[model samples]
Target chain A: MKIGIIGGGAVGLLFAGYLGQKFDVTLIVRRELQLQSLLMNGITVHKGGSSFTTRVDSDLLTEVSMKFDFVIVAVKEYDLKPLEKVLELMDKNQPLLFLQNGIGHLEWVESLPHHNLLAGSVEHGALKENDHVLHHLGVGKTNLALIKGEWGAVEELVSQSIPSFPFLLKQDFEEMLLTKLFVNVLINPLTALTRVRNGKLVENPHLHQLQRDLFQELLLLYPHMERNVSFEGVVEICNNTYENRSSMLKDIESERKTEIESILGVLLEKAQREHHFVPIMNVVYRLVKGIEREGLGG
Target chain B: MKIGIIGGGAVGLLFAGYLGQKFDVTLIVRRELQLQSLLMNGITVHKGGSSFTTRVDSDLLTEVSMKFDFVIVAVKEYDLKPLEKVLELMDKNQPLLFLQNGIGHLEWVESLPHHNLLAGSVEHGALKENDHVLHHLGVGKTNLALIKGEWGAVEELVSQSIPSFPFLLKQDFEEMLLTKLFVNVLINPLTALTRVRNGKLVENPHLHQLQRDLFQELLLLYPHMERNVSFEGVVEICNNTYENRSSMLKDIESERKTEIESILGVLLEKAQREHHFVPIMNVVYRLVKGIEREGLGG
Candidate 1:
């Protein structure tokens, strides 16, 4: 089955770069500059000292070429609506997988009458160098679990295309998605507001206590959640991701609307609906909202 | 009557610059460079945007051309012993004024059987520009208090010299020294370690609460003690010197052996002596000691 990747940022381009060689792939980038640049320089995937560039066709994304077997949305969470309208034009039988950090996408897509949407999580610290360039600063597993059917075929494709990196096909979809959401809520808002790196948290006892506070509050609200499998038993991922900017931190640093809206923002709403008090998360949400209201990211 | 000024640092040089006009003065500096610089260029007082330079003989200190009627020891409190040895060569009938912050000078000088040791408190923020130059940043007041016999003549002389600025004839020498000690404990450690200016304290609520905790703890131990005096209703003299760097901050920034040993270190010792646990001060002392041990200033 042919795969079509939507969005042309690091996440989108990296996926297209990695999956292009194994399958029939076309990268759907919105801007003419991105398309032109990709056509000229290809897409650079930098890992360690090695780098590779891949060719992508932008024209295949128009409603005319909406024939792919799978569609992956790779934009920041707030930019999902316009592309969701475009995804409306695609074949409804094809599976849709979201590779964003936050939980709102699952809710948004689930609200629509789509039969084949998959909740996915990528802990990969993929950083965008430029319009058509990327850096994989950290290697986190890509978990793809179907909300409806078995992911055996997807697993086969992933196993065939695996490049010495970890990928997973888990059956417990909602809990897996919630676990990733828990990790995002705990780390992203904290690192964003405090302007500290992953390594710096352990240096300050106050911040370490803050991390535990967020964990306790999240656990109290969503007790059914499993610890983040990527970061849970594997205790060293946080230290390893030292000095590497979280995408939310990068958003705040670059003066862009952060994924806090999808992560903590939606969780706050859900907590209110469930009649639960999350003091720690409420603090993070309010601070980020104040930052956004001040036109900080505008 | 003749006077002798000890230490070639800014404090000694500044007093020498002004007091040289008032009395026949001799400045004793340890370093040959400082001694030669003062002898060649004269002590320059950069006060109120105008420069006043005054010349004094270098050999008069040892040549015994005149006997000292007053001696002002203005070195860092740590180097008190050399001044003690120098005192052996001087006339024993003179009154000595200590122009240093913190409380240990009283104990050290009290150990000597001198004729009279008058305690003086100067809140002037001065920086050593060069060996022979001093920059007086802020002008608060110098309070001269007599610790021994007949305060009548000394008070009149100090009152007549600076009738314009706020100078006090503080009879309560112990209270006056303790007042300066208490204020330095708060202002110096907070500003220097945090590397924050006085006004910047208002920006962070966390830091503000920490200040409150420290203040409240000090209040618990010493009830009804008000070091916070106002020329017009303001408590801290530090607020008057807002933009100026505290001497403690300058010491830390310049990587010098801090007066922390005499300041907070003495406070901790005093608290232990009184059998009362100063929780906040203990924390501050430990934190500063940790900073000193870590060579953070380096």
Candidate 2:
């Protein structure tokens, strides 16, 4: 089985390294430096104080000409627009899996004429240390669900998953993505704005109050979310990832672009469509954008 | 007339230096270091390219035994609780003026037996360079209004104002404080949370959107405020103080206690009493308090 992962980021690297153990994996990258490094030294993933290298075929995103059995789009949601044409040009029968954060891309993906489409929520915490090196911090499994077409491709990947790296097939894609979005919406922007570690969100009483308020706002849109994902579950995530800075917070500190638009931006649009007032989310959404604008010199 | 100024902060020093030029001013400070420095070097006002030194009397707040015809309480609103007993022991006829931010202190001041009570909004921009030197940045006048008193002491102070430091008498105290509160509520927390200067609130479009949302929330409680304080006026203040870091921002950077409780806390209480929904205010309020907790090791 041939699997192609588009994005040389942390998630893409982790997927390529783990999936390469069982299948032919190709890393499609845009940056020439990352492509050269990946082709020359291969991908190395560090987990539990041990590191292993996996050799995989690499190609520049612009020069990718080979067809794959399954392709995973792992780039950020904001970065998905530029690759829409590339994804469209692929074979219609080829199954495509999107591993981006937030459900904002679902609408864009629905517009594509692909026969088999899959959406995934990556629960594993992976950090890119260098061009070809990744640090796998958490051992959480990737949850995959069918967005459109048959689940044949998703089942094949789940059945062939490597040891210590697991893939779980979920029935409902929207619920899976919404659960991830709920956690991201509550944790990412607040942690970014406060510039604190994840644990501080629940540990600090005032921040906890703000988080609860944000949770209440989210519940207004999807009242059933309270049952599936309790407020305590969100707090537990913060406590479990106690010492790690959120991706949004890291982006702000490093002056990199954040995925806030993919997260809170989409949530706000949904709230507006439903005529539900989510003032707390609105405030945080604008604040993260403002901070991003200031950091990115926009 | 003899005047006593309590609290040796920037506002206290600014008041003593200017008011000393026209009256016998005694700077009563809590810090022994500030008291000693004031007694030795007096108070120096640095404005523009020139500087002026005013030799005012100095006394420790705990050791002060002298009586004054009038007194100016220049401490922060949060610091007012500890001074309540001391304020009660002052001469009953001695008119007291509060130079603090927020209207939270109004109720406490009204309970005093003093014959006259005044609330003044200090518009001048003063930075404490040291224990004895202050940099007067903006030359705005102080707006004084009678809270609960005969206007005898206020009229005397206005009638005998010093040069370049003007004092204007306002008829409505609530209106005057609310106007100032409107600006502080909009500017202080946003700038502090973003760690940007005052101008960024209006300059960054995203931050500006958040500021507008906050303005709308405030207007919901005081609908008449739309007539008195225009949203543009708040933006103008941000533009005018473009390079200045708000006091709350400075406090956060320095790891000092912020006035979040006095400003947003008081506003939240009022919002609760009125049953008004101010979600944005609630979020920023708790975020600032959380940051304060993390910074101050609370």
Candidate 3:
């Protein structure tokens, strides 16, 4: 099987490195520098106390022409607009999987003409060190759900799971995405705003109170989230990734754009549509956006 | 007239520098280092292109034993608890004026045994560079209101105003403090939380929206605040202090204790008492406190 990972980010490199060991993989990136470096060094993933180098075919996103059995979209949600044209030109029959963080891309992905569209909730924590190097901080599985068409591609990926990185099939796409969204909504912005490690959300009483208030505000929008995601489960995730800086925090610290629009932005819009008063969510959303503006030379 | 000023902070040094020129002044400080520095070199005031040094007697807060016609309490709101005992031992006839921010100190000042009590709202933007050096950033006046007892002392100080350091008397103490409180509540926490300068509160639309939401929440507690403080006035203050960092922002950056409790904490108590919903205020309050803990070696 041939796999095409459509980003050189942490998740993209992780997938390309592990999957390349088992199948023919191509790592596609937008930057010429990253593409040149990837062509020279391939992908190196450091997990636990061991490290391995995987030799994978690499190409620039605009220059890539070869077809793949399965293509995984690993770019951020904010970066998806430019790829729309690229995705449109792809083989309509090819199976495409989106591995973005938030459900902000669901509508866009559903609009694509691909026959088999998969939405994934990635639980692993991966950090990109440089162009072709990544740290696989957390070893976890990817939960995939069929957004449309046949589920054969997702099932095949699930059956061919690697040792540490497993793939599980989820029954409902919205529930699967919301489960991860719940954790992201609670953890990401708070860590980013406070510039603290993940565990501080639960460790600090004041932050914990703020987190609960935010959780309550989110529950007003998705009343069924309580059944899908427990409050304690969110706390457990913070404890599990105690020392790790969240992706949003990392982005803010590095002066990179964050997924605030995808995570909190989506919720703010939903609240407005439903006439739900999510003031805390609104405050957090605007704060993160304001900070992003400040970080980006505003 | 002999005037004893308590606190060696920006406001304290500012008062000592200007008022020391006309009256016999004694600058009181809690730290021996600041006292020694002030004793060695008088208070230095740098305003625009000119600089002036005013020599004044210095004494530690614990060692001060001299009598004064009036005393100015220039400490932060959170630092007032430790001074309660010292205040009780003062001469009953000596009028005490508090130059603290927020209305949190009003009730506590009322409980003092002094014959005359005055509360002041400092409009000047002063930054302390060292133990005895201060940059007089903004040349605004100090608004003084009589909290209790006779108005003779306040009248004397108002009549003997120093050049460029004017003193205006306000009829209502609550109204005077609330006006400053309104600006502090809106500008301080937002600037500190976002780590932006005062100007960004108005420059950044997202933060401006958050500020407006917070202003609306505050109105629920004090319906008459609209008359005392205009939303336009708050924006104008941000514009006037465009390049200045708020004191609370500086406090957080220095890892020093913040006055969040005195400012937002008091308002939170009032909201609870009246059953008002100030979700944004609550979130901002908790986030600042949480960040304070993180900064203070939590």
Candidate 4:
């Protein structure tokens, strides 16, 4: 099976390397430097204290006049808007998995067929450069689900001969999504706003309570969040990736629009739906919104 | 009735000058220049576009041997503890009014009769040196409360006055104290930790959001609060005093231990009462407690 990965950066390249272990993978990168480097020297991945190079089909979307079995969108929140052309280029029957931080954004995939609608959750970090060198910093895990019906191929892929980033099936994907939403709301926007690393969240006085408050309050919105995700698990993840900068932090550093709205922003909306109160999150919303409006994000 | 004011700083001198407007007031100010200048040239008070001078008792605390009806402790919070010997000069029956921010600690006042527990909440800005200058910038209204009730001459003295500098009996004193408590929790530690000004809170993304989140969470803690002070009233005070530097800002500027403990440190204390559940205050409490241990106050 030929899988077309749309995002050129870390996640895209990592997935390409993973799936390329068996399947023929082609990566769609944007920049000329990446396309040139990957096409010339294949793609090099630095993971597990070693470096491996694999020659995958590396080309720009304009260079490709073909279809694939699946197309994964791994771009940043705002960058996904430009991926419309990639989706249009996908085979009508091919599945599309969106790997993102927050949820309530299925409308963007509305143009695609319902049978092909697949949502996935990824918990990992990877760094990439224009040279197509990928640095797998921490854990790698992906849980995919068919949003509508029982798609057997997805589960078969989950039990594949080669695992793509330790891929697995998420039972009742919405709950996992909600669990992720809670974590991101507590982690991403916070680190992004505070400019602190994941582990350092425990150290910062201005933020630690906020994390605790955010998690406690979001639990009111998603009552089963704690039941699914343990605090030790979250804190361990935070500490293990302490040195790694969160995507939101990088976005703020690069002067990009924050996914705060999609993350904590949507939580407040869900609070209204769940008849739960999120006073702290509302404060977080007003603040990040003000920061966004101050136009500080370039 | 003889009244002595310690700490020739702005607040002290202002208290001396304002009280001198009616009854006998002697400001126990230090330094030859401050004393000579205040007694020589007098205090220049700029109020409502009109400037005036007042000649009052401007001398050192050591020189004050006579018993006074009232003693106003107008020193800075840091200087308050060291002034224990000076506060000892007070007459046993003398009511001591404290006109400073943060809590007026009572370890020293423990010996005094309960009626001697005097707390004053004033909104006044005064800058003084060789120039005895007190600028009642916008308003100088003071709210004083007797936590320990003893009929004093100053109460009648203030009430019978021309209603100038509007002094009111803070009916429910604890609310006023909590109003100031919220200020400490919301403004002081935040500005101290961030090392920014009131206006800057609206600018910096991370610092700004932390303030709002912590502030709103505090208000959400209103039910948990022993006092239900008006948030709007505090905001108005903050807006009015936006340009005015707070005690915490001043402490940070001078490099001192923020009274974050005196303000929010108590939140960690196990509930003494059955009706207490200060979950929101715990956020500020833990943050400050951590910073305190890390010795960042220096």
Candidate 5:
């Protein structure tokens, strides 16, 4: 099976490196420098105190010449706009998987004519050191669910999964995505606003109070989330990933755009539709949005 | 006339320097170091491109012996509890003036048996350089209103006002304190949490939106406040004091305890009492409280 990933970010590079071992993989990057470097040096994967090099095909997103068995849409939600034409031209029968955070892309993905669409939540922590190298910081399973198609359509993807980088199947697409969304919503903006690691939210009493208040608001807004997961489970994630810096904080530190719109922005929209009052979320949403605007310029 | 000012903070030192010129002023200080410095060099008042020195008696709060015509409680709301014994020692016949920020001290002040009590909202910006020196950043008027007793008892306080530090008498005590509380609530926590100056809230669109949302919630929570001030009025203050660093932000930077409890804490209490939902204020209150805990330890 041949796989084509349409991003050169940490997640894209990570998937390429791991999947290149069993099947042919091509990384479609935006920058020429990243593409050239990847073509020259292949890709490096650093995991579990061990490093390995994997050879994979590389191409610019616009210059992809061959069709693949599966195409993983691994870019950020913000970068999805430019890939509209590319996605439209792709083989409609081939399965397309989205690995972006937040539920912002659900509506957009539903509109696409692709017959087999999959939504994935990447649980593993991966950070790109450079254009051609990535460090798999944490080993975790990727949860994949069918958004609008049969899971059997991507059976090749399930077969390619190794123990080190496993892909677990989820039955309900909404439940899986919403479960992930709940964690991201509570964790991402708070860490970005506070500039603290995940653990501090649970470590500090006042912050824990704040986390609980925010969680209460989230539960009130979306009670269905409560049936899927508990607040303690979320706190457990904070404990487990205590030292890790959230990607939102990294985005702010690097002056890059954050995924706040997809995460918090989506929740705010739902709150508005239901005419629910969510003061805590509103304040955080505006604050993170304000910080993002200042960081990214307008 | 003899005036005793409690607390050696910026507001306390400011009152001491200004009132010492007209009245025999004795500043009640907390630390021996501050008392020694004030005794050795008097108090320096820096304002409007000029500086001057004024001599005022300084003593430890425990050593305050002489009865005064008026006593100004210029300490923070948090520090007021420790002064319970001292407040009991104060002459109940003489008017006592409280010059703390926020509405947290309202109920406590009312509970005091002092027959003549006045609440002051200090508008002037004063930054203490050291124990005995202060720089008056702005020449704003101080608003005074009777909290529990007759205003005529504290007439000497109004009479001693100088040109640079004028005291403007306000008719409605609730109106005056609530007005100040409104400004503090809007500016203090936002600047402190975002670590921006007062002006950035208005200069940044998203922050300004958050400010407006918070202001709307305030108006809803306390409709009486709406009759006293408008949202545009608050924005105008933000514009006027654009370069000003909120005391809370300064407190955070200095690793000192913030006035979060007095400002945001008081507002949250009111929201709880009125059964009003204030999400933004709740989050900011908790976050600032969390930061304060971390800064001060436990």
Candidate 6:
């Protein structure tokens, strides 16, 4: 199987290295420097204090002209609009997998001409150390659900997955995405605003109370969220990633646009539509949006 | 007229310097170092481009004795509990004017034996420069209203007020305090949590909308708040104090206990009692409280 991954963020590099192990994978990086480096030395992934380099084909995003069995859209939500032309040019039968953080891209994905669509929530913690070096901080399962089209395409893609970078098939699309969204909504913005690591929210009594309140209020919107995921499970995730700064926090520090709109922004709109009162969420939404508008992040 | 001002924070020092111009005023400060300096150099007031020094009487809070016409309690709400013994020692008949930021001190003041009670909403912006110096940043009036006292006592107190620090008497106590409380509730906690100056709350579009939502929600509890204060007035206050850091923001920066409980805490309690929903306030309250617990402030 030949796979082409678009965009060269941490997630893009991570997918390229792992999928390159078994399948014919080509990484379409936006930066020329990163593409040159990957072409010269291949993609290097660091995990468990050991480093492995995978010889993956590389090309600039604009230079990619060949057909592939699948294309994984691994860019941020804000970066989605600019890729409309690229996505429109792709083959309708070639299944496109999206790995964005929030559910904000659902409407846009539905509008695309692609008939075979799959959405994924990446649990793996990947950070880009440089242009070509990707650090796989934690090993977590990537859950994939079919947003539209048949599951036969997904089965073909799954057969190519290696044991190390495992992908799990979820039955429900909304539940799979909502579970990840709920956790991200509760954790990311708070850590980014407070500029603290994940564990501090659960370790500090007052912060913990806030987390409880925010979680309780969020559950009101999707009470079924607890059926699939427990409050303890969310806290456990925070404890496991205790020392790690959340991606939202890292984006704010690096002055990159955050996925707040896809995360908290979508939730706020839903609250308004449902006419449900969520005070805690409203405050956080405004605060994060305020920081973004004030040029802390675009 | 003679008066004793308790607590040597910005408010206490502001009252001491202004009232010292006309009345035989004595400042009761907690710090022995501040007492020694005030004793040696008197109280200095810096306003506009000019500066003036007044020979005001100074004494340690532990050593305050003799009879005074009235005692003005100019301390934070958190500091009120520790001063129970000091308040008990004062003459009960003497009018005690309490100048606090929030409505949290309302219950504590009602528990005191003083029948001649008054409340004042201080509008002036004062910053403590040193042990004995205070810079008066803005010229605004002090609105006083009788909480449990006759107009005779307030008349005597107002007569001694200087022109720069004029005191204006209002008819209703709740209306007077609630107006100031409304502005404070909308500004203080948000600024402190975001670590921005007072003006940023209004200047930032997202923050301003959130402020509007919180203000609209808080008004349900006290519908009469807008009769004396307009929403524009609160925005004006933010614009006027654009460069000045709020006392709450300053407290958080200095790692001292913030006045959040006194401000937002009281409103949250009232929301519970009245069954009025205040979502944004609840979230901001928890965040500020969390930061306080983490010892960014007490």
- The parts of candidate 4 lying over 4 Å away from their true place are A16-24, A29-66, A77-86, A107-111, A127-134, A148-165, A189-197, A200-219, A223-227, A242-256, A287-298, B1-86, B89-97, B103-257, B261-298
| Model 1 interface RMSD, one decimal | 9.1
Give a tens-digit lDDT track for model 2, residues B151-209.
Answer: 77567789889769999999899999999999999999999988888899988999998
Residue ranges of candidate 6 with Cα displaced over 4 Å: A20-24, A33-56, A148-164, A205-210, A216-220, A253-255, A296-298, B40-50, B53-55, B150-157, B296-298
Report the C-alpha lDDT of model 1 over B80-147, residue by residue, as the tens digit.
Answer: 87556567766666777787777777777776666677888886767899988888777767888877
Candidate lDDT scores, in order, read 0.69, 0.90, 0.91, 0.68, 0.87, 0.85
TM per candidate, chain B: 0.88, 0.97, 0.98, 0.77, 0.96, 0.95
CA shift of B70, model 4, Å: 8.0
Count of residue pairs whose backbone atoms collide, per candidate: 0, 0, 0, 0, 3, 1
Sort all candidates by TM-score, best to worst: 3, 2, 5, 6, 4, 1
Indicate the DockQ of the complex predicted as candidate 6. Answer: 0.46
Give the share of true interchain contacts found in each model: 0.00, 0.80, 0.78, 0.08, 0.72, 0.70
Measured with C-alpha atoms, the lDDT of residue A76 in candidate 1 is: 75
Pairs that collide, model 6: A279-B279
Q: Give the number of the best model, judged by TM-score.
A: 3
Q: Report the CAPRI category for model 6.
A: acceptable
User: What's the lDDT of the predicted structure labeled candidate 5?
Assistant: 0.87
What RMSD does model 5 have? 2.8
Which structure is stronger by TM-score: 4 or 5?
A: 5
lDDT of 6 at A81: 91
Model 3, docking class: high
Q: Write the per-residue lDDT of candidate 4 for residues A183-282, one digit (tens) a residue.
A: 6777786665455678777666556766777777877776767688766666777777878888777866666577887787667777888788666676
Write out the backbone clash pairs for model 4. none
The model with the greater DockQ, 3 or 5, is 3
* Consecutive 10-residue window with the lowest summed lDDT within model 2 chain A: A151-160
Listed in order, the DockQ scores are: 0.06, 0.70, 0.84, 0.11, 0.55, 0.46
Q: In model 4, state the lDDT of residue A77.
A: 57
By descending lDDT, how would the candidates be arranged?
Answer: 3, 2, 5, 6, 1, 4
Winning model by lDDT = 3
Residue-level lDDT tens digits of model 5 in A125-175: 888999999988867789999988766547767876777888888998888
